[model samples]
Target: MKVGITGASGYVGQFIVRHFLQRGYTVRVLLRNVQKTKIFCAPDGRFEWTCGDMSNDVVLSEFVDGVHAVVHGAYDHLPGRYRGGEGDNLTGFLESNLNRSLALMQLAHGAGVEKFVFISSRAVYASGHLRGNLQEHSAAQPDTFYGAYKAAVEAMVSAWAYQLHWHAVSLRLTGVYGVVNPLARSKWYDIARAVVRGEEYSQGRNATEVHGDDVARAVELLLHEADARGQAVNCSDRLVSNREIAEIIQSISGERGPLPPQAKAVSPAVMDCAYLQRKGFRFGGVGRLRQSLRELVEAVQKEQRSSQ
Candidate 1:
């Protein structure tokens, strides 16, 4: 099987590519800067690299050619840039991204690909907090423009799936952590470092999180699982509290700090992954969270020592 992935050098995209490659699928990645992804430039010929952005028609055309399936992980929203911040031109950003996304969907459908897996976000559930629990059939009320756009794209893909008789899966991801993406903002890393430095720590909200590896695995399962087709499922592992996260970081890094108080007596609705579990997808959950934190801390320490 050949899998074509957009934004293949990104944090999540890289993980998806690695997962597919590990499963023995030939992977092709679209990248704007091939030189930055030397780690994936394997000589074994299992991975192919195409250099271009997602907006290029010629590039998008060649990307889906002869591929069995395509994973659309490419997105342009940067933190604090296009999320309706002050002086942010969110309208322009949305217009551009929506155009690109719709075009890609059409292109992939036209390419005779077997399946298309769209990496969506849990933010699509704008009133998810109001509901005691989030479910697959729950009404979507996206608060932020990011959430709105994701919801919009999901709807578009679903429509195409039915209208065009295409197999499509949208994985609504939660806060994805684990494995260091140097350019990405990882709250887990921030908390771990605070513990390592013995700094005062506090958290504003508690939320669910899933490891990058687990998310990749979910996408892989959706590839062959008939039950996953034409479905939009929440892909999350465990409900994580801020205080619990601090404790886990402290324990794993062996760093003592002024930890925050235990999370308030509140059982918020966790993103429901029961659907995924029933489909025979087992998640690593919080059992491996500490080990992942340890690896992240060790990597940080190694980089620090090398720099010094």
Candidate 2:
């Protein structure tokens, strides 16, 4: 099988690429800068690359050509933030992120791709207090432009999958954690870095998160599983607070420092992944999380030492 993917250099995309390569598939990635290919490719698998982004039609047309599946993960957003990713270029953001993505979808369909996976976010659900588990069927009430765009794309994926007779799924992900490499930081990088330095930092909040590897697994499941076609599945592990992460950081670093205090955050809702659970998909829970964070801490230590 050949899988074509955008955002191959991204945190989660890196994991998806690695996982797909490990599964004995020829992976083709679309990238504006091809220099990052070294970060992803291994000796055991065949990896191909395209020098373009979502905005380029000719590139996109050729990118999706002759692939079994498409995984779209690229997003043009402000650095380190999604809600206000548009910054001052609202029109540009819409053009690149939303409009061009729709173009990619159509191209994939035209080329007879067997499956498509759109990486949607949990931000599609309305912000504020959630009364119950965030089900996949929950009505999308996006509060940010980022969430709104994701919700819109998901709706299009579902509708198109139905009409085109293809296996398509939108994996609604929460905060994706775990590392691509020791130098490649995932979620919670800063907190872990701060703990490695034994410095005082404040990020007293919690969020629903999942390992990047598991997110990749969800993508793998949705591609071939008949039950996943045209479905929106939630992919979340559990709610992890900053304080708990700090304890793990200290434990791994053996720095023995005071932890961050528990502060109020607009968090607490956990996405219900009943469909994934039913599929016997096991997430790497806290154990894997700890291992990843420990690597992050050690990476920070290495950087610190190199600088000194």
Candidate 3:
């Protein structure tokens, strides 16, 4: 099966591409610049990339020409943030993300793709909803433009599914974590480094997080799942706190710096994943996180030593 995936060079997209390749699928990636494909693909040496912006109908159509499925994870945002990623240009943000995304959906549907998997975000849920037990059926009241855009595309995915009469599942992902490569830093790289360097980290944030590999597994499962059609399923493994993160880092790096203060008792939106669980998808909990963090911490220490 040929799977055409967008955003193959991104931090999250790298894992999805690798997972599909490991599963023995013919993976063709969509890239804006054809030459940039060498940056990531050279390592695996097993990718067929379609070079051209997805906004260009000719290029995108060529990409979806023979693929059995399409996984869309591309996003244009300001560096280091997603919620307020628009920064100064709301119109540009909407035009680039929402408009182009809808176009991709229409083109994929027209090209007779069997399945469409949209990488949606948990940002679709507002902070109010986070206070409760969040489920796939939870109502979405997106607070940020980023969330609103993702929610909008998700609605379109379902609508397109009705038109296609086949599989389309929006994996509403939480804070995705893990290191795909040394070039790509884990989400907790800075925090772990600060704690390792014996810096006091008082401010700690907590959220539901899943390993990147697990997110790919969810995508892999839904593609083959006969029952995963026209539904938005929550794809999160467990709730992770900043204090827990400090402890994990300290345990590995042997940092004696004070572990981050206990996070206050706040209602964290723990995303319910009963659907994924029933589908026989197992998540890499803290154990997997620790292994990934070990590699990340070692890299951080190596960088710190080299700079000194």
For each candidate, give its TM-score against the true structure.
Answer: 0.91, 0.96, 0.92
TM-score for candidate 2, residues paired by index? 0.96
Name the better of 1 and 2 by lDDT.
2
Q: Kindly give the stretch of ten consecutive residues in candidate 2 with the minimal lDDT sum.
A: 179-188
Q: What lDDT would candidate 1 get against the real structure?
A: 0.78
lDDT of 1 by residue, 149-190 (tens): 888888987887787778888899987777745622554767
The best candidate in terms of TM-score = 2
Best by lDDT: 2
- Give Cα-based local distance difference scores for all models: 0.78, 0.86, 0.84
Q: Model 2, 74-184: lDDT tens per residue?
A: 999988787889999888988989898899999998889888999999989987767569888879999888999999999998898788777888999999888665463
lDDT of 3 at 244: 86
Off by over 4 Å in 3: 39-45, 181-184
Model 2 alpha-carbon drift over 4 Å, by segment: 181-185
